[model samples]
Target: PGHQGTSLKVTDSPRKRGYYVNSPTYGGFDIMTATVGGVWDSFLGEGRRFWITATSDSHRNVEDGGEDLWPGQYAKTYVWAAPDQADIMDGLRHGRIFVTTGDLISELDMDIAGANVGDTAQVKAGQVVTLKVRLRDPAGPNANSDQPELKRVDVIMGDITGKADVKADSNPTTRVIKRFTAADWTRDGEVITFTYSFKAERDGYIRLRGTSTDELEPQADALGENPWPDLWFYSNPIFIRAR
Candidate 1:
């Protein structure tokens, strides 16, 4: 909530779908949910093209007991774009991006049929949508000088229920549809691959979350906890449009 019973007009015109900026530093702030409900609130129920981003917002040096890390030391927003500035800007505008914390994975490319992240794939309602993913775990020490292992990856799906009460903020239909482990994926050196298929019962979106721990879902951070040991990575969704 933006205070006093107001919500972002994402279900309105494209011009009204405001951007969302989040940082791990304040994960428990939004309505005190400490989860992606706000993101799902805007994305699901309408298939709206809202955008989300993670930032450092670093201003002071940590050595002085400031609350921040050096840019990319613990968080990064990876854009699937050329090295050029304009292309990267375009990628951000179009949602071709993924985010990671503590360097859990270096790459994540997911596809459904011929559509990639931020792209829409057309399909029949009963069609089976094959998901192919390619990702890499650096397997090296992260900013914290600790080597972390990727424990699992989860697939989350949510239906496009078509608009919502402007005051609405939750999608009850959203859930984790699949979970992949070392046995569930193929490995080649530092890269990992996964394949899955699900029926296109309706229009929806799918996204990925990979972590270094066995926690079914990301747990809220605790004080004095080593951030690098509990790493996680998340990819922007791939929308599905079905007849």
Candidate 2:
């Protein structure tokens, strides 16, 4: 029961055993697609939550080798069903997922219960926590990918200590700010969100980052690369407890 070869030798045998012995090496050939999203966020620990599916381990449409990977090219986890031939594999095993390489997002939702972002659900004092995004437009835009550019939607709330300089035209679509709080919004979509209301004494945790078109530079670029083309979406951080 040990035959997981190729992908260039399971991504080149752990950097060839850390250069035979030198040590200090990184990159695990995309680390099995990032451990399939960190084994589903490490089994949704802590407060317990789970919902993510976008598999294509199709094995070349159930055939032979199929030139190794090619059936939807990667990505499809749009759960929350109502039209299917089998509930799309039971809504991807019950997790109503979403992930696209070509883009076809029909619906995306996020509620912060008692929101906070420039004062919406009270809790003032530099308050700010309102990230709502909805997208729908992708019936046809393919040619190997690259036609989904709906950038700038980052509303981060924790873990960077401090950062401010959002002036991509002095507020284009929407991005309100006012920090010094701590966690309470786990995560959202349309591209990135993580808030939990930080400030029981300021520990950390809260996120939101959805801006693409390769980010047009000057916004935490840092050698930006890949689909990170400005980071279209990422929200998964809502942990705070300082009592």
Candidate 3:
């Protein structure tokens, strides 16, 4: 870890606080969001690269009775990297990973339910099938949205050889009753809807990811009190019973 002479952006200080950092403290209706978005791709005049980690650069140590910042206040982005620390760093530097504060979303996939129609069978023709998921965010205080509204749902489906991103309509028809998003902590009790409808031709499956996108930093919203804006995201993809 003492390779300071390397080209990595070894900043001992914290990055500027953005949307996700400020909104929670004010009880905003919208939950703050943040994503790796993408890596720098390349830095420095040469082809050198470095890893981008979502970590709590908490400078205030709890040495005194006063705590500087909460433990794990920031996200810990783990790349699907090798045990070698250098490989881990390389994986992050090349945009090969993403960080989350709440859930661990390692993989997502979808498929059709049945080849033929039957009452007890999971899949059927002339019916809409779906996939869904929910991951855990270890560094988060859960979803802190103003009204707990999910805005986007992605149905990543098809076989291992073929895949596609199907954005579904947020409605009750495509949801798992009393599960997943339904039990999600949307305290406002608003009638948030989620749905994924598509006519099936053969047997297959789908993966769903429910997302709530809000300003990462409210103080920066174009029409809000903030001068800078940031983006927030939350999603958990799951395999659904499609018949």
Cα lDDT tens digits for candidate 3, 1-243: 011111112245322232244432211112212111111211111122222344443444333322222333223354555899998776554534444332222222222343111111255555765422223322323322222234333443331112221332121122222223444433223233333456654433232334444422223222122211122222212222334
TM-score of 3: 0.31
Q: Give me the runs in candidate 2 sitting further than 4 Å from their true place.
A: 1-46, 55-143, 147-150, 156-205, 209-232
Number of the top lDDT candidate: 1
Q: Write the per-residue lDDT of candidate 2 for residues 1-243, one digit (tens) a residue.
A: 001111212232322311213322111112211221233223332222334333333333212532123444423345556787698666555444444433433344443433311111223334443434344434455433555554444344332122233321121211223321114223333333333332333323333333334332223211111221222333333333222
In candidate 2, how many Å is residue 126 off? 13
Give lDDT: candidate 2, residue 86.
Answer: 91
lDDT to native, each model: 0.70, 0.32, 0.30
RMSD of each: 9.2, 17.1, 13.6
Error of 3 at 188 (Å): 26
Writing each residue's lDDT as its tens digit, candidate 1 over 148-218 gives 78889988888887765676677777778899999899999999998999999888888887887877866
Model 1 lDDT at residue 17: 8
Arranged by TM-score, best first? 1, 3, 2
Weakest 10 consecutive residues of candidate 1 by summed lDDT = 1-10
